[model samples]
Target: MTYPRSLLRAAVLAGMTVVVLVQFAAQLVLMVPGVLLGMVFLLPPPIHAGRVLVSRWRRMFANWTGRTVPVPYEPPPPPPEPDEEGLYRHESTLYKSPRFPAFFHRLDWLMKDPATKRDLSWAFWFPVLGLLPLALAAGPLLLALWTWVWGPPWGLPGEPSSGAWWATAWTALWERPAWLAALSVPGLVALPWTVGAVARWSAWLLAPGVRRPPSAKRVEQTLLAWVRCAMLVACAAAEVVLLAVSLACFGLGFGLGLVFLIPVANSHFRWLANMRRQFAEWGGVRIPRPYTPQLRPELRPDGLYRVKNNLYKTETMATFNANWQWTWNDIASWRDLVWLAADPVVTVALVGAPVAAVVYGGWGLVFPWVWTELFDADWSAWYGAVAGHRTLGLLVGLALVAAGLAVPRPLLVAHAWWTALLLRPTKAAAAEAALRERVERLTQTRTDALDAQAAEVRRIERDLHDGAQARLIAVGLTLGAIERLMDTDPAAARKLVAQARETSATALTELRDLVRGIHPPVLSERGLGDAVRALALDTAAEVNVAGELPGRPPAPVESAAYFAVSELLANATRHGGAERIGIDLRHRDGVLRITVTDDGDGGANPSRGTGLRGIERRLGTFDGTLTIHSPPGGPTVATLELPCALSSPKTSTS
Candidate 1:
């Protein structure tokens, strides 16, 4: 039963392999024309078809192996929507019809997805490897058929002998009929193993999320490092050309007065430097851009715009001059020029040398053997050979390749250090950059505070109008009704008075609740520590408060800290599924720090929750920061820090 089942599965896999081979051939045929002849429209269809085929195989293999294969492709882009003008936009151009934009979007989607390449690879390799299992399963049947039809070495009485040389030679080789039958048994026994092997190999490439074996991962890393080194070498060569062009442009702009070309060259080549800065991360260093902010022309009170000392009545001329001067005066611009001049020499020597050694060494190892042995060519002293000793050359080549591989990662780090030396901002420039960032953050926080203040005011007004004011109006009407009812009936007048009293009490409670929402009474009277304790009493979880401040924080800071803790507690209970929580408060080094830790299923993301973002904004008003460390399982800890002074302890007030 096992042997038959294995053969059945093998036959099905073999048929699938044929389909995969056809798909592979179709893709190769389309890819050539699509890439070379600009028929990109031909590319997506074959890739999409290949994905469908691969997806089916992935499911079958997963079912057979009882292991999951996650879908590795990114979600497709949303369909294009027309703007107010009823035109769809794709990149820079707008079109009346959605067809062109949709096509381009789909093309981008398919080409950019890594899974598509993996599918194409699977398509190519599966057909070649799939033949093994197919041959194993089918070999026994072929041998049986051959022996039955040819009647072993000697022809049967009724069987006609073949006169063909190949048939006669094949019949002569199989002397015994039993040997042919015996050969089929081993293939039948190996069928199941081959099938499992194919399933395992297919899953490795198809499942991107699957953890690779250590050896495979190490090899991939080594190859990727080599690729990165090669890319750096190529980029260094490109930078040399850019440096020459930049020098020429600077000469023309400054020396010959081609002022327009100056900004063009500066702006265009700046991206390459920025790319290199980004790539510097591979070397375990980060390089930030050093250019100053581009400020717009400020309109003066004298009815003119100022660019430097120069003033223009028209805005356009002033703006252009400002940009030109800004670029020209930036110290970073000169630093970039210097970097462009020096990068080629440094990068080529540091990064390129290893790659060159590897390439030359590989050539010496493989090509020399091929030329000397296969073609019987004379050995040359060039390459890795020494005095026509091919064996010596092979050994030298092997060592050189190993040496080349060993040094690329370290050399890459060295290259990054060199990049940082030229491209990173100077001390003064870094300070200015920090100041500019501080100003920007302050501006944003101010805007947020204003918006929040307006929203709070609107909320207060709505509550007053809809709750307290309406109840008070009702109380006044009831009192007036009582005035009328007193003369007619004393009993009804008494009842009306009682109803008005109850309504007034409810209104007062509503007003107090609204005030508490604005600034909690406990926070003002008892300070932040006692207020947070009062907050914890109302929460669902068992909360333990630890640590104490020596004195009270400023009212505003205390209020912000209280509310921030309240929000964290609420998040822990509501979303984090916390059962127990701990709150700690301290004033250390003039900074009030509050830590809230919760034992919960903790995966808190501030960006996703408005409660957290509101807490951040409220804290930001006082130059406070919220940092959370929430791993997936349990125990989320959120720390809130605010820089403020603490005053002497104040007496509790009613």
Candidate 2:
């Protein structure tokens, strides 16, 4: 049988999420075991099993949207380190536990997992959110069907509770043909459109979003942002309503405790925070300058609390009353408060009002007319009273519905632009932020470089300890034994000397391997070209190298490029399943560029692998870059570029 339609997929999913989604909000208490029990024993296993349940929903979303949702779970944190001889003072790696005197780590992945939180949000919102779009699409049809099937009670201005309303509705419809045209025609035609809208809604909320890059056109960006911002605004609206009701209780000389509950209800809700960030990003507003209030840490003994201003803030609160001066010094906070106050107005104007108008005007206008046509005692009298007006109403309603689809985009753009106008930082502020960000990046780059250097040193130490040094020690013992035996036993001495010779050769090989790992001797003597060619020769796949440098790159750049290409070649041969590979290296305009292409099983993601991430971090130290293009199915291309000059004439061989 063919797969079920997309229309039913969400509802089917709603049915399937028995424990995970159906009563998720109600059953959230179950997570206590999943989270708290992680400390006492191996609770992560069950927690991981929950990931299996979440994967089902991901599949459902993918099936509906035709886009694969990448699982967003973070890799497990590193296990505790052990000391010499695979023992520890008090530690345990998740993999090897019994070797150490370790206690259960109190911090559970369950409590901090982003995937789990996303799953929870999806579960809670799917059923509730799906209702709006589905209802919009199907609700009108159902209402029309209800009216056509079960008419209004008794008659116009008549009994609504009457049981015989359906019989009378049919009789009234038969007498008046205009009732069917005006009522049922528009809704039936609009069914496809409403259904599609609802589908997009579901896709946006449930499916992994196809996120747009920052450079996308402002209009398109705002259109998508509107969807996300609308959801956030809706949540904020709920909080507002609750807080209002709470405030009103105090006004009534009742429920005085509600006043105290306001902060508990209002503080640190991330929806508004998220919306603000979205506004700043999509609306093209520069990020606000950060304010650190004190030299001391922001955290308090009790909990996290950010001080709101720079230490010894000097800005005057000109409008501050003497009594309120203490609270009013920071104008940024007050500005944010104003934004909070005006949120409802902006939200309605930008999102809620326009949508309602279109939906109601196009599909909703027919309802009153349907009732009037079906229940009117004198159809001819009412019809004869208004003739062209009925046609006028039809034209207007159709226009409204048509405008509904087109106007929201323009409105969204305008709102974004306005937000940008209000929230955009001054040019001076932006320049400062830019400088600060650059400084931060450079600082991080330096740190990464140091870390890479430290790691390299440790690696070299490890190699010497395991390979060259051990082999040399063995060779020394073998030579010592041979010398001791030479005079005493001549026949046995010859065998000992032969073993010593073999040990010396093995030790020399180990030293060569260690040197190659540090920087290939070919790379130092012959430069990058022969080094890459030599690497290709070692791989099983057919490899070709082209292009020549005017001169060789600096030693560090050459070494980095060789290692990067080596990694790529290894990847292609092992994981990529390549049969053939091409390497093209050239130096142009003081920058050396290396391009590697492989015919292989593709779909390589640099973000997913440690090797690629490490390469990127390594390159970042020298302002180098790696760009990967590997579409699924076959063929992969990786481009590595380094900005540096070459040395004198370089030696090379294949």
Candidate maximizing TM-score: 1
lDDT scores for all predictions?
Answer: 0.81, 0.60
Estimate, for each residue in 203-276, the C-alpha lDDT of model 1 and write its tens digit: 77788644669998877777777778988988888898898787788789999999877876675578898999
lDDT for residue 321 in candidate 1, whole number 0-100? 85
TM for candidate 2 is 0.55
lDDT string, candidate 2, 271-343, tens digits: 4534554655544444453221212324445543334342222223211222133223433334344445565
Evaluated at residue 345, the lDDT of candidate 1 is 85
Candidate 1 yields a Cα-based lDDT of: 0.81
Q: How many clashing residue pairs appear in each of the predictions shown?
A: 0, 1
| lDDT score of residue 581 within candidate 1 | 98
> For every model shown, what is its TM-score relative to the native structure?
0.70, 0.55
Total residue pair clashes for candidate 2 = 1
Instruction: Please list all clashing residue pairs in model 2, or write none if there are none.
Output: 293-309
